[model samples]
Target chain A: MPRSVRVRLFATARLAVGRAVLPWPVPEHGLRARELVAALEQAYPRLAPTLRGSRFLRNDRYLRDLDETLRPGDEFAVHPPYGGG
Target chain B: MAVRLTRRPLTLAEAERRLRARPGGAVVVFAGRVRRDRRRGSSVVALEYEVDRVPALARLRALERAARRRFGASELVLWHRLGRVRVGEVAVVVGATCPHRVEAFDAARYLIDELKTTVPIWKEERGRPVRRPPRRRARPGVRSAGSGRAP
Candidate 1:
């Protein structure tokens, strides 16, 4: 109910974070994608490596770069390098 | 469908049927199957595949478009299976129909390679522990020849 970002993790990212989704609290004004990533890395050191190789998505849309801002209630997804055949 | 991600089995017949949608002189179909491999002394029995549905489907559609634009593919089928897939079972199939063989082959190859790196899908291996031979028991008679205490 409170202002928070729903962070989705998959594959190695999910393994590291031990969850498929995390409710990350953020400022009402929104947070820079870069800063949010930094905070996630700081919070879950094990997920740092995966974060470095992952692509970010906000509301199911790919983020061109980390410069994009993520607002409250947004769904942020972390996609690791794909291994599908 | 030109692009799809489903749990159902992928077959060449299905791919061929899809490729029949439009007329083309040449067709190329590629199927990838799970392999029975030993990992860390365990025999892999199956693979559990997972996918981020929306993104994965989006990428597949993008690949389909690229194939059509680059290779002039008249028909295409890109299908991948999710959930448990046993060794030797088809896991994915990508095919293309072009005016000639060269383009068909090239397009099929591109579709598969790009799908591997672009699609949001991953597979986890499931293995069965290796069985070890039973230890032989020594014969219980005659004080055991060479029992070191006092020969």
Candidate 2:
């Protein structure tokens, strides 16, 4: 069975993707954050620009390195620039 | 709680009440309100605020801890309102109580500034179109009531 990771989008990312969450299929060994994002952009052309200006979080923790691996069932969040006050 | 991401309205009075309970010598409160800004030709009627709750709450708590540690603040209130907030409504309140006025002010400023840049919250403005009354239509074969020459 192919492993699946939960991809979550927020703010502008959410707007671009038109959905808050997506179940992404990955390899059994999982894939790097960078690869996952590239795949997402390929899948959703409209989301590419937003992803360029976004930050990534893996399971509630900020993913400072795109090289970080995302395992199955993990939650990956795409955060656009914050506008809170 | 010192850190809050609620859907309810925010108030400076409530923030003051929370911070004043601490034994600090100085307390400062700052409230941010939605403004009726003009976008293009439309007027802003409200702001719809959204948040990625889990991460936002975590960031808020982290900010609260940092404010206390860095400024020696004894009490703090960091509240942000979610959902639709009308113009002039309080959207956020950040306050801190510290041993001195400088620390209190600095902490309050830092809290709000960091929250703006770091928290996973966003606002989209909702605009209303300018209204104009409809023009009166002329009736066929009807005489005007105020006309000097009757028909």
Best-fitting candidate, scored by TM-score: 1
Taking the tens digit of each residue's C-alpha lDDT, what string does model 2 give over B1-151? Answer: 8988888887787888989998999999999999987657789988899998999999999999999999999999999999999999999999999999999999999999999999999998898886658856669878656756656
Candidate 1 on B27-139: residue-level lDDT in tens?
89999999988758899999988998998888888888889999999999999999999999999999999999999999999999998988899988898998979855666
The second chain of candidate 1 has a TM-score of: 0.86
Individual DockQ of the candidates? 0.81, 0.71
Poorly placed runs, candidate 1 (over 4 Å): B132-151
**TM-scores of the models, in the given order?**
0.89, 0.88
When summed lDDT is taken over every stretch of 10 residues in candidate 2 chain B, the lowest stretch is B142-151
Candidate 1 chain B weakest ten by summed lDDT: B142-151
Compared with the true structure, all predictions reach lDDT values of 0.90, 0.90
